[model samples]
Target: MAGATLLPLATAGATAQGTATLTDIAGRQVRARLPARRIVLGDGPLAYVVALLRPDDPFTPIVGWGDNFRSADLGGYLAYRQRFPTIDRIPTFRGSNVGAIDIELAISLEPDVVVLNLSSRAAAESSGLVARLARAGVPLAYVDFRTRMFENTRRSIEIMGEVLGEPVRAQSFLQFRQRQIDRVMAPLRDLGHRPSVMVERAAGLYDDCCLSYGDGNFGELVRAAGGDNLGSHWLHGTFGTLHSEQVIAADPEVILVTGADWRLYSPTGDWVNLGPGADPSEGHARLRRLMQRPAYRTLAAVRRGRVHAIWHPFYDNPYYFVALQKVAKWLHPERFATLDPDATFRELHARFLPVAYQPGYWLSLNTDS
Candidate 1:
């Protein structure tokens, strides 16, 4: 695909027309031509870009993207490929996770705008990626959905829309997302007690004891879902590991494990294979194994069958309302007795996703739990 034809957003020696200056998530002034016809999106933020810009034709402006879509979430990749067969025709650059980006290959694609996650800004700057891209005359836009989801996710989407010339559609998506969140939060506004929840971030992904989010991402999601996150109180930043004794000491009421089919990364890994089209039996079996871990086996939450598993990638994308709703239902079942997160997810797909909604994003031990 290296020889694939490039979009004519600009000629070799001339600047594109109708350039605009905007502030990116990194507080940097980025001057780029408006209505970017060629775009290079980071893998983690690719789902949001597609959903917001062209839910029906996501490959339209994508000239290059990281390989996480295939390596991290095979179920999601298959769904998109089924809808848009030509998706594979687009060029793929080296992923941003393991190593430095292939600057030469990215420049060869000639993308008008490159979208990256704000979490990687420090690495981009320290590695001189910013200077190199500037010299190459390629514009970069930083967006975030993980850190400070409430504050910065919308701004990132707005920035993307402004650059892509889809401000109206972007606003529409934002409104839809807010409504979803409100539906879950408004009803529980008056609840006096919050469930003490422990979120195990990406269990078995690294063969470690316990990893979790602290005061951000899943931690914030727990709060938004009317639950108290033990990680936020113990850890200092967004992500950290806790000793097994500490988790047992906290004795959270709900133990939510974030997992995915990480076989590509760790072939024999113990992480849960829970995503689109996953079988409940398989998911439950994996959850059972996770519960057997020494750190979890003796915990009250595990013994009482309050343990649950959710998709891991929800932390990376903007459309996290589904996770929030599910978490709310699990943490406060009586309060949100009538809430249906599965139906809400299907509704979201009907309104925005190009592909049909496939079940199995999350699973719990027993329905009555």
Candidate 2:
């Protein structure tokens, strides 16, 4: 909130001309053309937020975007494509990271504004893409939903709303997001116990032992859901790896592995492919296989059937509040017995998304719960 500000228009004439001075989440002041007619997304998953702001035509303003979405959330991409086939026509760069962006192609698109994630600020500046875009008379804005999720999610949504000229819609979505999160947090104090949780980041996506969240992203979500995050005690950053031995030593009460439809990224890997329309039986079998890893085979969580898998994309998107509700229920079943994450997601799709809802975002080893 500190750096996200929309300055008053210079005059009615400028307002009529469709331009406004605004500050991005990175504290950079950019003068973006109002309701950006031509917008390039630095990360493709950003479309998830944009769709919430412009449910009718999320891709109309997007002339180009990064390629991460297709590979990272193939199920989600396919869902949108099924509804809006024209999405395939949008130009996409090689990678989601700023380093992999084709700067010349982005500038050649003649975009009114280029929106990148806050994590890309350093790369954008160091690589001189920011300066180059500035010289091209294009504005570059940064929005973050990953690195510092809770601190910047609202501000990022506000910035996107201003960029899209849908301030009212953005506020409505934000209020809805808050109400959902409050469902989990407001009743947390009344709960008697906080389970020790280890969130395996992209579990089985790689052949390595483990990757995990430390103090941000899903790590923050775990704490909000009334669980003590084990990774935070060892790793200092948002993401890092934990030795299999460390995982065994921690012996967490709950083991939540973040997974997705990673077949595109890891064709033969053992990742739990959990996403829109994913097969729950297949996902459950894969999750059980992951538990067989040396790091988890003897854990109390696995033995007690407290192991679960959740969609990995929630760590980076605005829909994380839904993940929070689901996790709260998993950690404290009796206390959050009636809280329904599936219904919450269904409402989100019905209210804001252009596509219909699908129910393959999560899976659990203990089906009885």
Candidate 3:
């Protein structure tokens, strides 16, 4: 057989576009040559990368979601269902990791390529996933975007697209995201409305807001969404557990919570239970109740009814295009028309994403405000 085709890979680190050249979690050199058609996604972080690459495909192109309940982004996606209809039409997904991938099942499915995130790669490698997948005739590609940076995630998607023979769609999304981003961030018309913001994931422990982004992460989303995430003020590695008093003193006009633990699961109109542990909207409801309590009532978000539960990953993923629109409408109701982030998100989910039914996901707690 002819040797696999090779490209210069312009980047100093990229050995080839389709080769396993990148450092796998186990520190082994995993390289690919040109492209891979069959793919597997083992974790939620990869889901963000995939969802960003495309938004409304009828089925999850790759396979597996590591139990959607553990994912922080599902709540936001489910919340967004109300604003978009196409998302609801897509089909559900089912698959497992390489180690757990029923060899017979995967072989029956017949895929040339597969993917797993950096964090989970070590586990996959420790389990001898490489050899296992190879024996099954499936090539594995490992990637990570936990840092939550859009550029890196975009590059990751472009890499995936090239291997999957969908680079054009990936490029289209990259450009589409850039255009929307440029339009939203042109310049804040309401200079005075720049609200100091605080975002937290309500994990039951009020002090555990450490899930918050300090910098170079979802904090950037707050900026793009038209507010200042005070957490960005802290060093990237330093996340503060501010007291209720601190928040009151800061008096941020807005509070954005990662509502992933809420009861809402699917992104298709009105809230539906993602079943038992998969709910993220419940967490948001709880946070709202906390904000309205006596001690916290002094805070601005609750007082002014500016509290919002958001799918924060969009802040750093291709999904951020929808994130920006949501923030624009949330931050400046009078200055801007509702962007219908659900629509944009649905389109992205349908066009570039292989997953079906990701529309009508965003739910508002303080719509009257």
After superposing candidate 2, which stretches have Cα over 4 Å from the reference? 1-17
TM-score list, all predictions: 0.92, 0.94, 0.64
The list of candidate 1 runs beyond 4 A from truth reads 1-17
Model 1, 283-341: lDDT tens digits are 78878888888788988888788989998888877778889999999998888898888
Across residues 1-369, which tens digit of lDDT does each residue of candidate 3 receive? Answer: 011222222222232345544443334455554444345455534555544333343123444334432334454445334334344443223333335544455445555556665545656767676667777756666554545455465666666665544566667767877877776766565456567877764423333323456655556666766778877765454234555556667778877665443333333322222211343455345556656644357875676778766543443344656666777778776655745665666565455444443333344455521
RMSD for all candidates, in order, please: 5.3, 5.3, 9.2
Ranking by TM-score: 2, 1, 3
Off by over 4 Å in 3: 1-30, 48-65, 68-114, 118-145, 189-193, 202-210, 238-241, 261-287, 293-295, 312-317, 349-360
CA shift at 97, candidate 2, in angstroms?
Answer: 1.8
Which candidate should be chosen as best, given TM-score against the real structure?
2
Q: lDDT values of the candidates?
A: 0.78, 0.87, 0.52
Q: Let me know the TM-score candidate 1 reaches against the reference structure.
A: 0.92
